[model samples]
Target chain A: MTTEFATRHLRRIRLVLWGVVTAVLLATGGALMMRSYLLPPTSEGISVEVATIGETDIRSEFTLMDHTGRAVTEADFTGRWQLVFFGFTHCPDICPTTLAYMASVLDLLGPDAERVVPLFITVDPARDTVPVMAEYVAAFHPRLVGLTGTEAQVAEAARNFRIWYERMDDENAPDGHMMAHAGHMYLMRPDGRFDDVFQEQDQSPQKMAGQVLARIQESQDVK
Target chain B: MRVLIVAALAVMLPLAAHAEVVVTDPWARASILASRPGAAYVTAESDEDDRLIGASTPIADRVMIHAIETDANGIGRMVHRKTLDLPAGEAVDFAPGGMHLMLMGLSEKLVEGTTFPLTLHFEAAGEVTVNVPVLGVAASRLDEGSK
Candidate 1:
């Protein structure tokens, strides 16, 4: 009689323990579902201090040639994150090296990376044809977009971004003529405002990406 | 095959010259990019004050000493050199934004937090072994101020 009673008591305890576990799990799942429905994925737990661009009195416009050499305006960047760099195809060293770093940073950014677009706007539009850009950017990543333009359009774009570029004549040239240009990567907001500028000499992709990652604290914390 | 042959040549050339080539920063501790390709500062004191005859790295498929060239427009470019010369104990700095070794066709992307092996050959230092700590992304000389 005692053994039978003891077995019945153990069954009751097990049933109560399972009920508590189920209740806890259900509450947690409901809370998560409610949170997801209430907030945008990127709208919570992230804070950033914007570094204001100094040109308070002026708004700038640019027209550059995309990889297709089709004219692209500032509006082309709408509704997406633009991580733009000013460089040339012939830059053989700094330009590619820096862009490759940016690519690595993007890779590290993981899921939300889809929101950022890596754009390479060349200062040497005269020499960097669309085909040249296509070939060059292919080495970096599938998403890297290269931009060039006619000399006039290229100059206008450079002025807007304050990019400095010039062609140097090498007498015993590797390819006869080459362009040397500054290395600066800019981060454009979804609305195309100049959100941040990363100077080649100032920041690495990791540091810049860190800034980007900081904008998504909760997502980052999940890791 | 060619990379090994060149690396071996880079090692043998210095010994053949009958001069001791010492690479001071074997670990390339003072790396610009802060780390990677193992930044090494090598000094080749020579009997005849010879040029930096050649260079090689066993860990790297193609290692070339490189320098950045910035033009008036302030855009940067890269130029590869065949050799750098050392005149009797003078040191050559293979640093970033200046003269650096370009490690091409790496067998693998080095582990992020770990540094791997590299060997630098000089006209005098026949073979100097080193392990370069992989570092965060590289920022250029111009960026040195920011760093």
Candidate 2:
């Protein structure tokens, strides 16, 4: 009887230990879930936010001429998707490459490309006049629009877009003048609001088209 | 089990295709434009070798290497040179407004989404072939990595 009683006591102890172990495991799992769910941005660590620049809050005012010297304003970008690339006509490579990519993107998108307007905003207004821009842009895609303004207006537009441009002089330059301009593209929504921004590097026509298609779809769903 | 096998194959195929270059941070490439002369660009490794030798395209007349020269005043001038050497893996870049390959005249225009065959003759690595997929004509400035 004493042996049986001892055996029962040991069984009860073992059962209690097992129950405690299971409860601890469950509690640990629950705490981990809670921690992950409440994961907050650390103050010391590098923090990044999506669309954190909030550049859309600012609006760029441009008193510029289109490719044909037609007076254009920020309102021209409204009611249609516009892709604005900042550069100069003297930029033999980047400017042309970007326009060509946009042309391809337009072609790939087919009819939908019509709703998407492509604009080349020149930082070098001295060299890239309305006519020169028209011709330079025509070499890439006919549908692409080119915009140029007074240095002041151009600078204002660039500032709104958070782009930088400066003129560098070259004593030995064949023309004795130079313009080192910023290179990037911004996507303005149909309402003239800044929607997306693309880098100067690491982009393909397929990727661009894919992004446009996806964004268009997403926007449609939201509407 | 079957779905898992197929998914593995799908991932492996493209990786095998791009086994040549990882392009982790970023690397630049341009499509061999069709219907005209050819051009080439590089996504350079800034910290590594910065030397380039010769660039060749199967569709081009000849691969002429060139880089842009910007004087103190910020004027950019294109100077054609024979070799751009990247020493000890120092990254030499060939992006717009800086160092680049002036792909003289092309046999055709470089259209987007098309991959062009380019042979790069590096000073150290001998010869490496890169499939340059063209981006856009006006999109030429290539800055890689987080600046």
Candidate 3:
């Protein structure tokens, strides 16, 4: 072959390779720009994308007995927002205090309380029987519902909620034992999806109510 | 003679310094269906500094002092308190969500409307007994504030 023809072929191959590299670089830059747009950098300079990528929606369902000994399930919590707490009636401090605080929050919501249901699910089912729950709940808000089921049923509900609770046996305890459980309140959406969780300790009723109402309003805006 | 006088003064000093522990609005939550644990709250004050070492009630097998606190995991748990400081001229309130006298193993049901005897033991004030009215389970410090 002639030297001129060989040089022309080599230049053409080099030009084609350069074009491919430029196109690949432009495509990658565009994709990264789109991702940055979707997830803005938080104050910590870390995009929420990394956090959301590993997060899976929590869909939990369980059948339990209410204080009245009536059978209820997750379906019963439909059509309204549910604020569920896991605790026992014998819980001298946190349980009643949390209930009272939640009641105050619901009261502050006023008529809006109708749209929310406060639930107290006992982690110590062995002691918190139906009658015990009935009296225990009546002491709190009228809108509060106390639920206690069999050991297996309670365990299933706790598992679905992904909460940790263990019966701490104290020989000196008045009830013969105590249940050490998570103290966060779970806020569930009308469609039975996990919405938000609130820590009851040291949090005022008004602030918690504001957070809950804001979330509900945000959810409504999305719809 | 000076030694005798000092000895007498020493004996009378405790009685002279026996600051009165005033317990007001003393109340307790009525027991629910079964005889479970209950808590009693009171506003205590003294003319001089005193420490509430312990509390007791005839209705319970034993009375305990407990404070509700959030642990490292942010979970609320009850911690037994050995003593509560009460400064002079300042009222210390044992209210819900804070410190309270836990009545364990009630001898009788703390029914609403009934009154039970609660004795408060202080370091310098000796023992002061008060009748704690049993209010409904929903009663709290705010409820007493209205009255």
Candidate 4:
């Protein structure tokens, strides 16, 4: 009789233990679902994490001539946000594709785009002259500015921006040469400070515009 | 009689296989500058395994198949490919920022709304020419609306 009583007591204890374990699991699962539901939506597969200037040694300083044959420096664009891209007109694929993407980004920004200046700086200054830059930039967007300077000037600008470019010889190319350059775009603040960098993979127009708009809003908030 | 019939079937089979390869949606990005090279993309499908050996066009001095490869640091470099395999029953796409036909020494600017002829040479299919439409300077696809 005593053994029967002990077995019955043991079964009751085991049932209570299982009940506690199931309650814990259910609570954890509910919390996870709530966390996912509360999180902000992300763009497709892109991460919305903003990379600030503190992480990199990027600076905004350049002395180059605009497509209109006017000499300008970073100081001229101190009051406006800058979107910079480095490429050559001889580039058949990536350059044109990227320029088009920039144009779309500007369009998506609408009136807010007025506060942004998109600059296309040529890494191959030897072939990309003022006239070439003018016609090329005009084809994409009227507001888009093409910058080219002397070899040393362009090199200095590239160095300040931490851009790496090299001329590769191709016997079959149009000019018997081609240029390979870093395909990243830079976003700078109105105060002429580096703000963020967008890699080639993050070329979505909506996502890019949203990121830029967020920065613009954040700057205003600080003011 | 049986041997003669078998030889005739052998010759007809290769010809039928060659006829199965089809190229569609051939288009080229309009050259922003006439002095710069142009890029063209197309979709090729084959019923039998074949190889894209070469391509040619009267508008360009040299036509080369090129691919853009990005390094770990996101630097893009163009690599020339001698040949590309087209496996049976699969479609191969040559598009922007990917495999493309580099049209070197363009005779004239590729104007929008215009079409040019591009001849593709295959290892088994011989030569096939398709009229390629010229899209906008920044056009990614033929159906993409004006931006």
All candidates: DockQ:
0.07, 0.13, 0.14, 0.26
What residue pairs are clashing in model 3? none
Q: What is the docking quality class of candidate 1? A: incorrect
* DockQ of model 2 vs. true complex: 0.13
Which prediction has the highest DockQ against the true structure? 4
Q: What is the C-alpha lDDT of each candidate?
A: 0.57, 0.61, 0.73, 0.80
lDDT string, candidate 1, B1-147, tens digits = 999999999998756667665555432322222112333333334554656545555555666566556666444555556777777767765544356665643455433345666665555446555655553333233223124
Error of 1 at A43 (Å): 50
Question: How well is each residue in A1-223 modelled by candidate 3, as lDDT tens digits?
Answer: 6999999999999999999999999999988865554333322111000001111464446789999999999898898999988877666655666677777888987777889988888877777889888888887777889998887998888777776565543332332223333256778888887888775555777888888888888988998
Model 4: per-residue Cα lDDT over B1-147, one tens digit each: 999999999989876655467999898898888878899999999888999999999999988887755557544566677788999989999877677898988999999989999999998888989999998987976677244
The TM-scores, one per candidate, come to: 0.50, 0.51, 0.70, 0.78
Best by lDDT: 4
For model 4, residues A1-223, the per-residue Cα lDDT tens digits are 9999999999999999999999999999998865554332321111111112232667778999999999999998989999998888877877888888888899999899999999999877878889999999999999999999997898888877777665544542222223343356889888777898875545678899999999999999999
| All candidates: interface RMSD | 9.9, 8.8, 7.1, 5.9
Which residues of candidate 4, in runs, are more than 4 Å off? A1-55, A172-182, A199-203, B1-19, B71-74, B145-147
Model 4, CA-based lDDT: 0.80
Report residue B99 deviation for candidate 4 (angstroms).
1.7
User: Across residues A1-223, which tens digit of lDDT does each residue of candidate 2 receive?
Assistant: 9999999999999999999999999999998865543333221111111111245554545778898989988786677788878876544455556677777788888778888888888776766677777767787788988899886888777777666554543212222222333245677777777778775455778788889877777888999
TM-score of chain B of 4: 0.83
Quote the lDDT for B58 in model 1: 57
Q: Measure candidate 1: CA RMSD.
A: 23.5
Ranking by TM-score: 4, 3, 2, 1
What's the residue-level lDDT of A159 in candidate 1? 67
Model 2 C-alpha lDDT per residue in residues B1-147, reported as the tens digit of each score = 999999999988765443122121122334322222234566544233434567778666666565656557444445557776555434455655455554544666566556677777654445567777665444444332112
TM-score of chain B of each: 0.57, 0.62, 0.84, 0.83
